[model samples]
Target: MKILDRYLLKTYLITFISVFVILFFIFILQTVWLFISELAGKDLDLMMVIKFLLFASPKLIPMVLPLTVLLSSIMTFGDLAENYEFAAMKSAGVSFQRTLRPLGVFILLLSLCSFFFANNVIPYAEYKFINFRKNIAQVKPALAIAEGQFSDIGSINIKVDKKSGDKGEFLTGVTIHKKSSLGEGAKTVIRSKKGHLISSEDSDLLQLVLMDGYYYEDITPKNYKDREKMPFAKAFFKKYNINIDLSKLNAKEGEDDEITNTHSMLKISDLKYTVDSLTTDYNKEVISVADNLYQRLGVTNYYQVDSINPKKPKTPELTSFLNNKDKFRVLDVASSDALSSKQNLEMNELNFRAKKKDINSHWYSIYEKFIVAYACIFMFFIGAPLGAIIRKGGLGLPIVFAMLIFISFHFLNTFGKKFSQESGITPFLGACLSSIILTPLAIYLTKVAINDNGGVNFDFITEPFRKISNFFLKFNKQQ
Candidate 1:
């Protein structure tokens, strides 16, 4: 290898590694802060906490790696330009393109690595991370009850305004909703001024003791006409004890083997399989709904009538078909059928929309794997040329430029994904939106760098205004 090539590669690698570590650390801290509530009072051991963070950290790579590439490219090239090393290289007959050759090869390899990581490691980590959370909640039922949010532990949904104690055993302003066995929803509501949670590792029950509470149970009347009254029984109590069964809350052995079916947890091959199945199911459902609605509305009877008599009207008016009394009866029955069909169609439309969104989500996930890989190369082009043109390096200006560019990219990416998920656009377009929007900028920067333009020219914009001002000024002077 030539000395210049080696030198450039070395400088870039050093900067890349340094930037990656710092950024990764910062993101990990952010992750910790984001999930602090889930981890704070859960009494998780050190190993479990580390495992949680470890599983989550892989997901950050798609965010961190591209930014690292951009920042490092800008910093490396910017520093060289600021130090006049680029001038020396230019004088020595080394072109700017030649300087980028070595690092470009490295970036190509890194992109492949990024693709592999996204396709395999990230999905696996997502699966494990999700399962870990579920296991934690099951193993420690107390962790399920977070303060200020309703938490479903088994059949009961419990909410607490405040919790204080060594293990958050003391609760204040407790509200409990017990779901009925008949699937009638939460018919029984319990409100308490204070409550205490008691549980043991060896036992299969969590005991909740409420003090100064009110119990309200909704009563369903036998007569359908009286149901509108919404009668309920209420009673005040000084003390109440409830035993919540924890048999199912105990984490069974090999529970993680049950795969999580979320799109994020699927690799490319799995995603393709899922998308195909979901699409097939969606098409079948649409066909079934259409056929059912066709039958329900009696459209076939009209066709049959037309087949029997060619002269019969295919769509007869209401008055032409029957006498006054018979017409009224038919109209009432038709109205009822139409109303029922409308409701059915509306419900099916919502289901179809939801299913389509799910399919789109899977498609987006597939595209995202490739997107992360390509983003590395994309950011590098933008960063390397931008740094050369700006002639600034280090943490000050490069950081600002990197952040603005990356923030724009991230925003467009998020918007596109969300919009695509809602079926506003195709998944492919959504995944590639940021890249499409920024391609021209990368090209412009590279062109300016190669042509020695120093920076973007504002002459066209300024010269027009200048000429206008001069024309006005000359007219005024002549007058």
Candidate 2:
């Protein structure tokens, strides 16, 4: 490599690393802020909180790396341009493209590394993070209960109107719906004016002590003939004590293996496999629905009618054999069949759309692997050239421009992904929409940078108006 290439590459790499660390930390802090409320009162150990953050951090890499690349490129090239190093290089016969060459190669390699990291590391991190969250939830299952919402703990769904006390144990206006274990239409409903939940760390039992409570239990009648008034028992108690088994929560060691089936938890190859399978199933379902609809309508052959003459109009078959009542009945049955068939087809269509959405999500993730990687390449082209063109260095102007550009990129990406998921557009178009939009801008910037004498012409935008004003002035002078 030449000295200039090496120097530029070294500067770019250093800036990129420094900016990446800053961006990564910023993103992590944002993540923590978003989830801090839910995580704070859960009594999670500090190490567990750190582990949660650690597991969650890898997901930010694909986002942070691209932004950092844009910022670093702009800062590096902008500083060089502001320092007149570009002029010196050009005087020494080095073109802007030549200056960009080494950095471009470096960015291309980085993009590839980013792709592999997203493909392999992101899935693992997602899986681990999901399980870690589940494990944390199990750590203090009672903490899952929020005021004004029903929370299911084992067989009982508990709702509390208000909670207070040192550990949020004292509850007011509590309601518990205990589901029946037996296969009977039986349930026990309990309401309390006030309640307190007490649980020990070592014990696999939760004591729910209620004050001024009423309990109602549904009773099944022994005789069917005497069931006109279904029996039920209601009782009021000054104090009610219920023991809840917490063994399940304690025993659950994040056994949610099915969470790995989520689209976020799958690698590209796994996603591809899932997408193919879902597509095949959807196609088969469509064929099956069509066949079922056809068969249910009793249409033997669409083109054939029971007639000797090819062109002869046959009498309507149903009216010929049946009276008006039978005809009406047949019509009613047909209407019902039609409605049923319509419902089935509608359901099938919904399922197909859902599968398609899932496929789109998988494909989106797959495209994202490349999109994020290529973003670095794209951003560099944009940032580097814009920096040189603007002739501004340091954090101030570069940061602003980088933020504006990144926001635009992020917005386009989000809109495209959302539209694709809704089946508004194809996955390929949606996934590549941002890159497609930015590529031209990057090229434009690069072109301007190459042809730029000293700076790009900002007055060209007003030149047409200036010409019109000049024309008006000339006319006025003639007048």
Candidate 3:
């Protein structure tokens, strides 16, 4: 029995490690493809790209590990059953549960480690990943601008028809639009035949130099006849220089703390603190708004107007006291004041609700770490038992089953979280929705495997569709 347990454990670990490596590599390759445009042609060093992937990899583990567990478990148990090893163990009076004991212990420890990594390591990795991308953008401002597209950098919008040269320093067919941040009327437009970006390590600015450009400025007309003419000034320049301030965009030595306020950068404890503080503050703000509105409108409470003193000029009915023009003026003033107050109150309420919703989302994220950790154990139960029942080995059936199950689980989790963030459901239910559905399924699969009952015959699933196809064929032949 001891020997059997050791063999099973060894095989399971080997398969798990192999599956994890392959899946992790595939996911990393997908990430590379997604970001290739941003990182490519930016003169990025190999080491920097490697470091970016490293920082980004931790967030993928929580997604990849459970799928790995599912696939590996299926492959391991399916191989054993196909080889008649399980039948031999059963003949020797070893139950399926007993055979699973060692692997169960290993899975339990792995779940703990997963939780610790998600709670402790992933946050730091996410923080670093965000800052690394930002630094990369700052390193080469041109990286922010894609070829043949308009890119917004600060107050200026730049479009390049093409970029060439070894370092992407030469550009052609450049158009620059300078947007006015103030309430000024029109934008300044500059079109150039060619342009190039100049940068220096010592200076915190990006210089865009253009040649043979035309600048256009719209001049506001002074009168109706001037407006009919639609006056504007255009100038041609041989050379032009525009300096963009890069002081804020450039990476600083110790700005990590400033960017760490995002929800992805916080641990469970920090998330709980934020949720609690925000809830308290939101409730206080609600109360304050109610109180302030009551005082402003001179009402004793929400449902009543004060009438403590009879002689204190009982609120006069404007329609009864005023006539014609005076009544219109008074009503107009009252309506305008009421509308302004209502708008202000509504805006404040909307801001408050948005903040509260954000706090709920953070709470969901906090619970997700633990939920994902337990998914590993649940996936093992599902995959192992179903695999034994199917009696198929290798990647063929196991990979398909694992993907279908994981995609369903991922969809449920994402949908639930989105609904929770929109306040349609509680955060607890949203975070645990996938686990709740999968737990019963795992238990059912275990029972079926233990009882030697075959789990879902594919023939049964396909029978109705097969009959429909046969009916159509017979009708077509008759016709």
Candidate 4:
């Protein structure tokens, strides 16, 4: 390699590594803060905590890697420009584009690596992370219930005012709401002055022992008039025992892949397969529902009307051949059927909308794997050119510029995804929205930098304000 190319690559790599480490550390801290509720007071061992962080760290690459590329590029090129090294290189017949070639190649390789990581490592980590959390709750039943807020476990919601003991197994002021099998909400409520959680490593059940508890069961009477009484069954107990099954939460020694169907846990290929299957199923469901509604509404009977009768009006009015009583009966039945069909259609519409949103989410996830890879190259071009144009270096101005640009990109990306999920736009467009909006800016910066144009000019903006100010001053003098 030429000396100049080696020098530029060395400088860029140093800056990139330093910036990446600092940013990754900061983001890891942010991740911890974000999940502090789940991690804190859980009595997790050091290895478990480290495992949790390690599993979560892969997902942060898409966010951190692009920012690192942008910030490091700006800092490296900005310092070189501020030191007049660019001028020396220019005098030596080295163009700006030549200076970028070495680092650009490095970025291209990095982008490829990012794509592989997103397609393989990230999905695996997401699967492990989620299942790890579930297993934690299973192995340590007390961790499932956080003090002062209700936590849903299995078919019951449990809340406690205070918890004390080695594993927070001793609870005070415990409350439990058992969900009804009939889908009528929580019909049974249990309150205890104190409770204890008992579990064994070998078993898949956690037993709750309550002391001095009251049980209240809401009763619904069959008769409408009797229901107005608002009846309920109440009983007081000195002690009670409830066993919660945790078989679903069990995680084998080295395999925690129990829950793996979420969109984020699927690689691009898996996501494509899921999307295709879901779309086919959705279309088939719509067709089946339409056919069922048509049959239920008796539309076929009209088509079977006698076509051979010459005297029969082609479009005879309803009740033309029926008595008044029969006509009224038919009208009532028709109105009821119409109302029922309307309700059914409305329900099906909501179901279809939810399914469509799920499909869109999967499609967006497929695009996002590619987006993360491309974002590295995208941010590099923006930052490198912008750094040369601005001619400032170090942490002060480059950090501000990097943050502003990245924040805008992140915001637009989020907005587009949300809008697309709601059916406002296609998933491909949503995933590429930020890049589409910012490409022109990168091109402009690169063009101006190549032509030796300095930082962006605000003359057009300032000139108008200056003219308005002068006009106001002259008017004031005349007055």
Prediction-by-prediction clash tally: 0, 0, 0, 0
Off by over 4 Å in 1: 145-261, 301-321, 455-479
Report the candidate with higher lDDT, 2 versus 3.
3
lDDT (CA) per prediction = 0.86, 0.81, 0.82, 0.87
Candidate 2 has its poorest 10 consecutive residues by lDDT at 303-312
Q: Comparing candidate 3 with candidate 4, which one achieves the higher lDDT? A: 4
Question: Candidate 1 — what's its lDDT?
Answer: 0.86
lDDT, candidate 4, 304-385, per-residue tens: 3322221322453555888999989999999999999999999999999989988999999999999999999989999998
lDDT of 2 by residue, 1-479 (tens): 88787899898888888999899999999988966765664556678788889889999997898799889988998999999999999999999998988898888899999989889998999988876665543355456567888866777888899878766778999999988988553378999999987876656577889999899998777898867886789999999998877644322335443343488888888989988897887777666666666567776355233322224334444558688999899889989988988888788779878778877888888888888888888988998998898777888668877998999998999999899988899888998999999999999899989997654654564467568889999999999
The candidate 3 region of ten consecutive residues with least summed lDDT is 302-311
For candidate 2, report its TM-score.
Answer: 0.73
Estimate, for each residue in 129-202, the C-alpha lDDT of model 3 and write its tens digit.
Answer: 88776665445656666677887666787889888875577889999888876757336899999998887665
TM-score of candidate 4 relative to the true fold: 0.79
Q: Report the lDDT tens digits of candidate 1 across residue range 224-277.
A: 999999999999999999998764443334543333348989999999999999
